[model samples]
Target: MVYITEELVRRRAEHNECEIFSLEEVSLHQQDIEKIEHIDRWCRDLRILYLQNNLIPRIENLGRLKKLEYLNLALNNIEVIENLEGCESLQKLDLTVNFVGCLSSVESLQHNIHLRELFLVGNPCTEFEGYREYVVTSLPHLKCLDGTEITRSERIRAFQGLVEVKRRVWEQEKEYLRRRAKEKEEAHRKTTGEQERKGSKPGFDGRWYTDINNTVYVQCPGLEENKENQEAAENTKLKMTVPDLEEEQRREEEFWHTPCPFTPESRLEAHRHLEEKRKAKEKEEMKPKTPRTLITAEGRVMNVNEPKLEFSLTEDEENNAIVLDLAVYRHLDTSLIDVDVQPTYVRVQIKGKIFQIVLPAEVQPDSSSAQRSQTTGHLVLTMPRVEGEIKVTKGASRPARVCETGRSSSSEGQNRKGHVPERLEVDPSLHTAPDYANIVPRQRAKEGPLERARTPPAASSSSLSDGFEDDLDVPPLI
Candidate 1:
């Protein structure tokens, strides 16, 4: 049982130059065997493809190969041939012993003018009464059938039968065309007679003659005067009952107040309103905020609000999220603290000094302090609180007030002054600051005082590293 899939055969044919390709009896089973899809792309010179005794059900996939000359799809499970319309150069198609019930598939082979031999012996089409007559009439170029030499008597009988059928059909079609042409001619004659009768009468061509005495008629000129008289009578009658005509005229004038669509101030105002609403909605959706903290060297702590900035960042599936390299500087040391820091994506505080920093999806704050060292350099931390020893540079210049990376100039101005500006102008009550200790690096508690509590009087002289968690210091306020 050679269970060769289409993909496997295609991959093998891609590199090989075998002229005769055969997957027959190879246990291939598919309802839709696209010929070119299974064949190798490099098999441009393939001449004969034998896919018989397999499970191909449709023939549409074979139309792509322009050079195909011979195809055998016999004795498997084909139902119809709706897909073989483009095989223009096919010469020999073996479809014998299939379950095809209709002559439609055989008729579609008419476009395959090069087809010389077709096998349809065991199909339902072959057992159909007048089957030979139908095939001979539809496909006039077929020379061989059913793996045998068609006897002279059988050929003569089939040709004679088809000739009589064609003759009868031709007579019916000729009668139909003759009747249709006769009806069309009668209709055209009737139309011409009606036009001639109307043209024989006078006063219908915009010219009126006044017959004062029937013998001496004069052409009544001045058609404009008649129109004016009719209009004057209509106006007088309407004005006698309708006093609201003046109001109708006023409304019509108001309806047509503006002649040019582009020049109207109302149109411009509506357009401006739409543009403003669009910009506001986009700003609301795209504001970036984070909640990471920075530490200052002077020991004077300043909570920095990382303002939401705008930048085009694209994400990758393999990398999971977009990487942003934030440039941090230490004003005290004049050293740049550039790091790939994943922004903190959490609710932000509305305090004037602190802003929000919205990070990309799949990016989260470093939950463990031990894991912070492995973070990539593309990170911008929104510091909730800044404390001593570590000078956190927000902006580029001296005295680095905590600033977010990639913020605009207008937003930078807002962060410069102590009070934070409402760049996004989100509802103040909806924001919440993240836990600062979870994201920010804090100084570990000293062990000198706690060590005294852990050691007994005898063991105080011995060195002990266990029970370190309980030995950590406690704040005076706690």
Candidate 2:
């Protein structure tokens, strides 16, 4: 059976940019999941869960979800409602289109006083006589049932009819239970018989195994969200022939149309079919992918967006550089990314996927720098252009540092107008010492040379010698 695994939960959580421990919402719908497990322990903080359209027969291993507010178990094989009394915050529950026949089992939900909405449409119990009156009176806190609002008058009427309706409901519930017991036995028998004949359960050649209209959509490998049509075309090309293709399709249709019992083996059969398809898909994906033609035979570089990531490339006039800002996934780790800076083009490889783009102008690969943003995760590349002309605006040079002496407020405001004072912009990553000697404002080329700092007047004849002649350093005093 396809049980919920930690790897699946963790992968879904990673895709959502959160860890399992802190995950508040999760969607495990239409995964062909036959059982629910691991999620209660892994996602204790989960508030919303979607487990719709699966083969899950029982609801268990979910009592620890105290924070759970909504649970959707529609289109499953769930026959009874139990073991949900611990969902203290549950406000809504969806069991629509399930096989829930035991109407009395919903009494287990009477403990869930916080439940405001309950959906049981298309279940066997919903067809039972006086189903609505029985359920409305049972779950007094329920405001909506099967998408219909439960008015105050409806509640009072249901309470008035509860006496007679409860007896009829109990009788119908017993009959459904007896019939389900027989189905269980018959399904179990068929499961074992098929297992014995096959030696082991074998997967059928189909994309999905539908039982009682519960469809599980299986995904193929190397096929992204937008590549479904391409994969389908590939599959058609591989499978379609003339005479045998039609015969095979006819047989497949006949097999599915033939009524079959929904049992453990049948549900597991779907899982195994998907498992085999996954293996075949992996084998197909392992074939070497033809890299996009970025460089032609004539040594001409071409631009390509192979990975289909959004990016912007612009000419930075002020810096005389080519700036490329690539919108990468924010949660992507740097270790999984590799960048290659070239004079003609830049290439970035993310987890074996390639994204290469040609530059508009020639650049200096040695002078190029690439950095990722901490918040936005945009990869900004600054590549100094090799052929770009550096245009300098002709203006009077201002003093790098103004050591103002006896200056008035008016003079200070006027002299410093449209001027920016220099500050020590230290970068922690670039381990270099500050150039203290260069801090003094030097005279500009058009300006006259300023007076240099003079030597100290108090320099004595003894210390004036400094380290020039130190009498052999006085026997090298330690």
Candidate 3:
């Protein structure tokens, strides 16, 4: 039921910069499209068209692709080789793994003199006796048949016996047609019997139900008198079925029909139909399945693979930051994604779909950063652990690295000059509060005038965790 809408065409043609008029190529494979439409009008300058692995029942609406050079219609429901006579520039045509039984349909390509290659492998017509000879004789210009080069000798032999080949091909075509007629009749009867069992009677419910919503009749002459009686109508005494169920029955009948495949992509097409029915049945059952909650009632973030994108999470002990590498689609735009970092977890919303995961350990949200790879489009998150945060001097009077006990900050954060700092472990029992106000100096006459007379703002105990050093000119408060 999926149609080739303007929005769909534009989205698929994003590589063409969303320009369909002058588009040269397009891939609309595996879209489950029941019919081919619009492309012939939308992309007139197209040279290559790939419509493979779909439910397309026929090859039409493509006669206008006069500039087309190669057309791929493999793995579809196409049963014939007609309607391609207008492709004046066609050089290659692929119709592999289809149900084309009428081998003589290959005669249509006689008009496409530019065609150099034609693929009819895995088709019912390929099984016919002297199928190669018939095609070779019909189209003397063909260079290859079913991937094999059509040698000059084969063409000469086919032309010499062209009279007998035509006679034999015609007899086989008639036999195939007779078998097809029986199949059509059987499919029609099976469908009719199923419909009879599904038919229902409309019972009294509303005046709208009895009249089938023909409100215009209510305004007509004699109908005005019946309106009063219709208002008091009841369904209690009638054999009334829910209107929704009746409507569903009508839809089901229209959904499952067999017209005898002119393009009998037999086994593969049946699989597609079964898959569609299973999905439809699941929707009708209305099963109540709750989505996985990213966060629990106890305020604990949970690990989840809801979107199931390929990803890898690892901890960098040397830098004390958890690095996450997510393999998002390289073509997906960064604008469609939103990232959120927390102490317990990281959440990413990619085009409205949420991908969340819990951290192995607590992290500092304020210090965390996220960036996307230019080449791979993989999202990389660097979350510095809270324990990895280090306190620095409250004043910029004397330049220095972090305290001997703390780790050095990155060059961008605070012009780091020293080597990578080693972790220092301290026993909690021996640790005590330090005199932050006296940590600097009470007198500094020997060191000349201070960088600023702006008395290093009184350091408060609460300033212990404030480590942001974006501005070097403004001294930090401890």
Overall lDDT per candidate, in order of appearance: 0.50, 0.80, 0.78
Better of 2 and 3 by lDDT: 2
- The candidate that achieves the highest lDDT relative to the unseen native structure: 2
Which ten-residue region of model 3 has the weakest summed lDDT? Answer: 206-215
For 49-151, candidate 1 gives per-residue lDDT tens digits of 6776654445655666557788888765465655665666678888876656545457788888888888886775564556666666677767766665555
Q: What would the per-residue lDDT of candidate 3 be over residues 1-478, giving only the tens digit for each residue?
A: 6898888888889998999998999988888787889999999999998989887778899999999999999988777889999999999999998878888899999999999999999888887888999999888889988899999888999899989888888888889878877876766565456434445223575211124221221223343357665433432123434336678678657656634454353444466557857886888688776777888899878776666799999999789889999988899999998999988889998887789988888899999988999999999999988884664548655553565457543333445346545445467897889879877675565442364434454456666467743454676454
| lDDT for residue 208 in candidate 2, whole number 0-100 | 30
User: For model 1, what is the error of residue 285's alpha carbon versus the real structure, in angstroms, after optimal superposition?
Assistant: 60
The sequence of per-residue lDDT tens digits that candidate 2 reaches over residues 319-346 is 8899999998899999998999998899
Per-candidate TM-scores read 0.29, 0.48, 0.52
lDDT measured at residue 148 in model 3 versus the true structure, 0 to 100: 98
Q: Candidate 2: how large is its RMSD? A: 20.6
Instruction: List ranges where model 1 is wrong by over 4 Å.
Output: 1-7, 10-42, 150-156, 163-478
